[model samples]
Target: MSPFCRKVRLSLAEKRIECELVEVRYWERDPDFLRRNPAGKVPVLKMDGKLMAESSAICEWIEETCPEPALMPATPDARVEVRRLVQWFDDKFHSEVTSNLLYERVNKKLMKSGYPESRNIKAGAQKIKFHLDYMSWLLDHRRWLAGNTMTLADFAAAAHLSALDYISDVDWNRSENVRDWYAKIKSRPAFRSILADVVPGFPPPAHYADLDF
Candidate 1:
């Protein structure tokens, strides 16, 4: 529920959607959690007493429900672009960076498992360069990752990037455009709660929460 949950939370905040934060230990396989989401994932949104799962689906639901300060663009083409980038971050970037760095370095220890797999960690570390480069390429050509307006794509990318930044895996120096883009997003009021998150046994880097950084 770490990166995924954080993504949903940030989206909700950005859209001014409010909900009670419920911490679900998915690994524990609690019955209550299973009932809410058979997938046993974090960030199961309970809105109007209706349960919702999957980060992307939940985000879309939020967007449809609360349209103010829209996370998706108004035009069809622009909306598609936003969705595309959202998938890129949640699926590709999450698998490459988040699962490797955050889950290996932190989650395993929290789960009372053995040390992290060096191979996975190495692969993730290596793969991140390619993703960061892709982001730089996108930012270089557009005002935002998806388009001129801030959209769900920004939140999706920021969610994964913030998690990596927490573990000190992101090389912001490699891409000034990406760095500047993140700095703008980080300065938003919606990002305040996420910047303050402190995962147990894992301390964020000094600049992780710094808006000026």
Candidate 2:
């Protein structure tokens, strides 16, 4: 239903965990959906006779269950930094960028909610530059957001950025470092499924699926 779901999806793909993609219009408030997630979220993961909700928690379970190609750092401090950045993207970025842009341009139509507010769209578009600038600043100093190696923080950031990129909202030319970083992640095997996604009434730009882009 949101970038949060994509965060979980990317985690599962990164770990090579074969799972079914269930499309849920959770905003409809279906009773069965509520049973899976009392909050009626679309990212509920049911596997191994267990039902999981909340994107962050589900990601943690995936990490502990499938440690191969670990997404967390070895040292406690590094891991803390990774988690901190994950929250930065998931909470702060979501509120500032994704909610304003993706929700306005995409999710509203999907939910039959209403016409997108121009002010919100403008706000999202304006706010994304700051977030992208912040990403550029981080990449200028390190190979990855949290450290040298990519971590859950990368996936969390990618989850939101990729969704925005799908709408052609990301200005990749703004920063070479950020563009290079995104190119690397966008080419990963884990990103293949996400790149292929298409929403009704909203077609992606050609560069959205172009690996060379």
Candidate 3:
């Protein structure tokens, strides 16, 4: 239903975990979905008869359920770093980028509103450069965001970034390291389904599905 869901889907795929995708039209206020998750979020995961809401919780559940191809570091400090990065991407990046850009440009039209707000668009456009530069700095210092291993943090970050990228809000040329990291993740088997996603009137940029881009 949203990019957060797609991020979980990608992580599950990367781990080779089998699960079913049930799209919930959250705004519709379906009684059953609301009962399952009072928050009415799109990514309510049902696995082994247990329900889980919230993207971070769902991701942690997946990591625990399927630990093989681990997405979290073993060391305590490293794990903390991973969690910190995940929070940065899901929270800070979301506030600065996703909410301002994707919501304005795509979500507004999807919800049948007027045009994108110029102020919000401009702010989002300006803020993304700082985030990209931050990503570039991290990539320059470490093999991955949290460490050498690709962790849940990567997926969380990618989820938001990919969503914005789909709407052509991301300027890939801002940072080569970030661009390369995205290319590596984009080329993964887990990313295929996300790349293929069609958002009605919001057709993706040609390079959205192109791994080389």
TM-score of each: 0.96, 0.98, 0.95
Q: How many backbone clashes does candidate 2 have?
A: 0
lDDT of 1: 0.88
Off by over 4 Å in 2: none
Candidate 3, residues 139-180: lDDT per residue as tens digits? 999878888889888888888888988988889998899999
lDDT of 3: 0.85
Q: Pick the candidate with the highest TM-score.
A: 2
RMSD of each: 1.2, 0.9, 1.3
Return whichever of 1 and 2 wins on TM-score.
2
Model 3: colliding residue pairs: none
Ranking of candidates on lDDT, top first: 2, 1, 3
Highest lDDT scorer: 2
Instruction: Put down candidate 1 lDDT per residue, 118-213, tens digits, no spaces.
Output: 999999999999999999999889999998888989998999889888889889999999999999999998998888888777778899999878
Tens digit of per-residue lDDT, candidate 2, span 1-213: 378888888888988997898889899999989998998876899999999999999999999989888999899999999999999999999998899889988888888999889998898899889988998999989999999999999999999999999899899999999999999999999999899898878889999999888
What lDDT is reached at residue 82 by model 1? 93
Off by over 4 Å in 1: none
- Pairs of residues clashing in candidate 2: none
Q: Which of the two, 2 or 3, has more TM-score? A: 2
